[model samples]
Target: MLTRILPPPGPARLLTVITMVMSLGQGLWMAINAVYAVTVVRLTPGELGISLGVAAAIVLLSSIPLGHLADRAGPRTVQMWSFLALGPLTAALLFVNGFWSYLIVSSVQAIAYRAGNNARKAMIAGLVPKADRVGVLAYVRAAQNVSVAIGACLAGLALAAGSVPGYRAAVLFTALTFLVTGALTAMEAPVPPVPASAGAAFAVLRDVPFLMFTALDGLLVTHALLLDVVLPLWVLQHTDAPRWMSAAILLVNTAFVVAFQVRAARGTGEPKAAAWASLQGAGCVSVACVVFALSDGASLVPACLLLVAGALVQALGEVRQAAGSWTIAFELAPDHAQGQYQGTYKMGGDIGKMFAPALFAWLVLGHGALGWIVLALAYTGLGAAMPVVVARGARMRSGVREVAAAGN
Candidate 1:
């Protein structure tokens, strides 16, 4: 049973453990950070919003450069240093008494977090064979979900206490997890640095087709905001379901992802298979939107049922989309520059995340059911377009290779 749950005693296992540890901290922080900022730290909502926006901008701008650094200076070393830095930065959050201090701490924390994540991706690509990358990552994701759930439960205890000391303890616990994960990260097998070449530092920027695909994938990834940002508010404001149902919806999604992400990732090692999975995932999410729309005017029982059904569909979509996206991100990039390429790829998701909450709030809270219909249409369009984008990217790469061969 343990073997099935964990990778054998190797770099894969080490990475999985690192993910679990890191996710535990993330779960704790995510659950209480907003409340802490508002009530404990005494920052207004606008200040909190500004701080998050700044952090997002930092992530978008810093990811590629940090990834490039990983490619040049070995992924393991870069990742270890990033994690070490993150421990201190996250610990600084306890000292954030005002808007400026919070902004500075959060932005720096975001940079360290982004750098470590990009290096981890590069390390995975180096350690795991292409055929097994997605499969291994799937297991890691499941482990992450499980760890995060446990961390959230721990956070719940702190929330129940509702004391400043309790909140501080949660932050301190999260900081300790980062420090432990950093120590664990140092144990992974080292991946040698990719030698840098003149004029090739930003080659991923020239890959227009890949950029387009990334953009589309980013848009589709907004399905996350639907679940995290929009759904709870929708249930509370527009539907007849009890307030507790919001938490139940998230529990349902978490259970499904933990149970089936690896199963959904199967057969998606190649680009074509991955593309199909993306489309399927998108369709499911779109259908979920329609179901959610139906819940708007439903009675209590039917509304709860519809929300649960929507969460299940959304979870399936989330798993399949994640599997496909990981495979495509790994398979499409040149192995020599996986760090930079992955960083560039990550920027797309950052953009989506930066805009999604506001966009979703307007659509769901402002416009209600019609907003869901528009979201459904948008998701379907993006998913349907992925196959063409992937094909175009492949063709462009093939052409570039042929040209280089002729020139040689």
Candidate 2:
């Protein structure tokens, strides 16, 4: 039964395993780092925020250049080296005594992390068959979610202990994961190089239609912040639901992703199908928002029921959006420039996340039920517009090819 569900044995399986290991460490660190920084390292919340903002800025600037490096050298080599660097850089968090040290280390770690991530995307493009890429990627994402859940559980144990030693142990364990994954990545077979155009190093930077598509995609993706930042606060402040429902919602979302993500991705390998899936995903989330808004003034039982219903619907949207995003990102890029294109695609999500916390807070926490209504409308508009944007991008690509043919 397990064999029936898992990807066929080969590069796909190995890559999935690597993703699980890496994400496990990431989850552990992510769950505990903010508390550790504030309580143990003695930084104020504002300082921590500043440090993270700087890290985000650094990643945005460095991703494309690091991806280009992967294209020039080999993805396997770049990925392995970046992970090796990450092991030490992550461990350095153990020694941070002040905000400056934390800021410097975290910013540097973000750069290395982005480099490895870009190379990993490039490696998948080079190694996985086009038909299987989305399926294999879905499997990897599922494995990542499962491993991260396990890691988060372990972090919970340390948090329960509430001691310096316990926190230090989690950090050390996270650092060890990077080393283990890096060694495993070094053992994988190298990817073959794709033949690229000799035109320019950053040709992807100038594709206006693709750039527009990315912006709209980013706007649609702010739903991530809705799940993470908005929902918990809404439950605590507005609804009569028990506080535990916040964690319950996350558990439900994770379970849905593990069970349904691969299935959701099945027919999305084509661009039109992917765009349609995204539209449906947006619709589902819109419904969820309305449900949640209605829960704001309900009684306890009704609020709990509404929250559960909203979580399940949102999970459906999450899976569909994720699957569609993966397929569209892969299909839109030229084969030879997958690394650069993937990096550019990543920037969209990064940009969204950078702004989403503040935007959602002001929109939802600031305005109450009316804010949820605005969000639903915005998400619906973004989803409805994706197909048209995709069509425009396709036309632009066709025009570019026609001009090239005329010049020849």
Candidate 3:
């Protein structure tokens, strides 16, 4: 059942675990950051949204350049220092009490955040066998989920300490998590790529299939944002649902991610991966629609039924989606330029988020659940179109060598 915190503890395995631990710690604070902003920092939803937006902006702007640097100086160079600075930068947030203070730290964090995530993915792609990529990513998903679970448990304990703002405890614990983990990352040896240069980084994105994969992923991410923004809004406004419902939903997803993410990441063979992802994507869209639709439909009995059904189905899709995305991205990404691909690929999601929340919010405001149904349909449509993209990618892969051969 893959119970260890990370894969067997060789140097690579050890380094991966440390990175996951640090990421999980930071991710936990992120999981609860909104709570800190609203409850302790006293930012309105709009204010917090703006803070998130600013953080997202830094990533969007810096991704290519940072990726280029990673490509040029080697990923280890960028990753080591990014981690070093992150320790103190994130730790300082403990002293922050206001909106502006939080904003500054969050922005800095966005810059540092991409390093660990991209480098790890790039490193994994470099080490693991081609067919085993999904299996490894699945294991990775499970490990990171464990870290998140630990972080959440710690948050609960800190809150129990009472009287002090949760922000102080949360920030300190999270910062230590980053600092300690980042320090551990420094222990690993560099895994530099062939023909390491900025030109190689940009050259990779020029590939037709890779860009299509990136675009499709960006669309999927943009669609998925509905769960984060709209689902909770429906619960809070349209029903007597407790605030804990959001926590419940998150926990449900996390449990699934921890449990099944590996299996999901094992996404069927390339031939079937496309159709499977489409079906999974469609299910995700349908269930999300039905659940939110039920909450707004004004019947507790039906809402409960719909909510349970949706969450279960959605969980399945989450597994499929993660595996499918990783399989495709890793396969299509340029080998010598995997780090750049990872950064640019991740950067796509951050860019999508910039527009998604505001647009989805506007859509809901204009039409209510009617608006949601429209979006649900739109997402489903995109889900439907994914197979075509997948097929095209397959054909393109056939046309290209899928490798950077010996000098031009």
- For residues 330-349, write the lDDT of model 1, one tens digit per residue: 87788888999999989888
Q: Write down the TM-score of every candidate.
A: 0.96, 0.95, 0.85
Error of 3 at 173 (Å): 2.0
User: What would the per-residue lDDT of candidate 2 be over residues 1-408, giving only the tens digit for each residue?
Assistant: 234236888998889889989999999998999988998789999999999989999999887888877787778988999989899998898999999999999899899999999999998998899889989988987888888898999999999999999998898899899988889998888976544554457878997767877887888888978778999999999989998999999999888888888888889887788888889899899989988888987889999999999999998998898888787887777766777888888889889998888888898888888988998998999999988877777677667778978999
Flag regions of model 3 displaced more than 4 Å: 1-16, 31-49, 94-103, 157-166, 196-201, 240-243, 269-275, 364-369, 402-408
What is the TM-score of candidate 1?
0.96
lDDT of 3 by residue, 214-326 (tens): 76677676655665676677666665566567667767777877877765655454635844675576668666765666567566666655655666667777677667777
List runs of model 1 lying over 4 Å from the truth.
1-5, 400-408
* Candidate ranking (TM-score, best to worst): 1, 2, 3
lDDT pick, better of 1 and 2? 1
Sort order, lDDT high to low: 1, 2, 3
Question: Which ten-residue region of model 1 has the weakest summed lDDT?
Answer: 1-10
Candidate 1: C-alpha lDDT: 0.89
Please give the TM-score that candidate 2 achieves against the real structure: 0.95
